[model samples]
Target: MIVISSGSNHANAQTSMNTWAGATAQRVAYSTSRLQNRPDSAVTRDVRSALWRTPNLDASGIRVRARLGTVTLTGWVPERRQISLAGHAARSVRGVRSVSNQLLSRNSR
Candidate 1:
């Protein structure tokens, strides 16, 4: 029987474990991103519905997009307050992680 060095073996094993851990972390991040993005369309629809349901807010010219639970509102609103209203409505929807309001008041143009 031959005796092997324990220190060398431990170092090599540790290196392998570290590599595996890094790969696993990357995979977990990727999976989480996909899960977050999976409901984007539903988020968009819900935001649009919220805007429509808001009083004095005309959603006809508004467009909504969602990614990773982040909602983006683009387009125009009739009144300046409507911009904030649209943003608030979008934020009120469930699953919305954040809101980017790009809406411009038609009166501002």
Candidate 2:
């Protein structure tokens, strides 16, 4: 009886997986590449989100600007290393064509 129940469950799972796959096949995949066609404001938001997600990077004071695919980051980070990290993060966003990192370390500023 238990074996029969497990087999039934497996069949249901497979059916659900197929349904989900079929439903999602035509759905858009949200990733960095999708941001390429987005506007500058959208690019700015994506860059800001990227900086906030970067490890060991303090983004509390960071300000992001985007213009014609050019990104400018201004503000202060807790550490000098975070400046480079912020730049890299900004550049990784798909819509960013260039980065002007103006981040100053807290101690340096």
Q: Tens digit of lDDT per residue, candidate 1, span 10-88?
A: 7777778888999999999998986554488889888889999999899999999998888989999988889998999
Summing lDDT over every window of 10 consecutive residues in candidate 1, give the lowest-scoring window: 1-10
Superposed on all Cα atoms, the candidates' RMSDs to the truth, in angstroms, are 7.3, 10.3
Candidate 2 Cα misplacement greater than 4 A, ranges:
1-37
* lDDT tens per residue, model 2, 21-76: 86676464545456546698899999989988999898999999999899999989
Kindly give the number of clashing pairs for every candidate. Answer: 0, 0
The TM-score, computed over Cα atoms with residue i paired to residue i, of candidate 1 is 0.64
Q: Flag clash pairs in model 2.
A: none
At residue 48, candidate 2 shows an lDDT of 87
lDDT of 2 at 92: 96
TM-score, every prediction: 0.64, 0.64
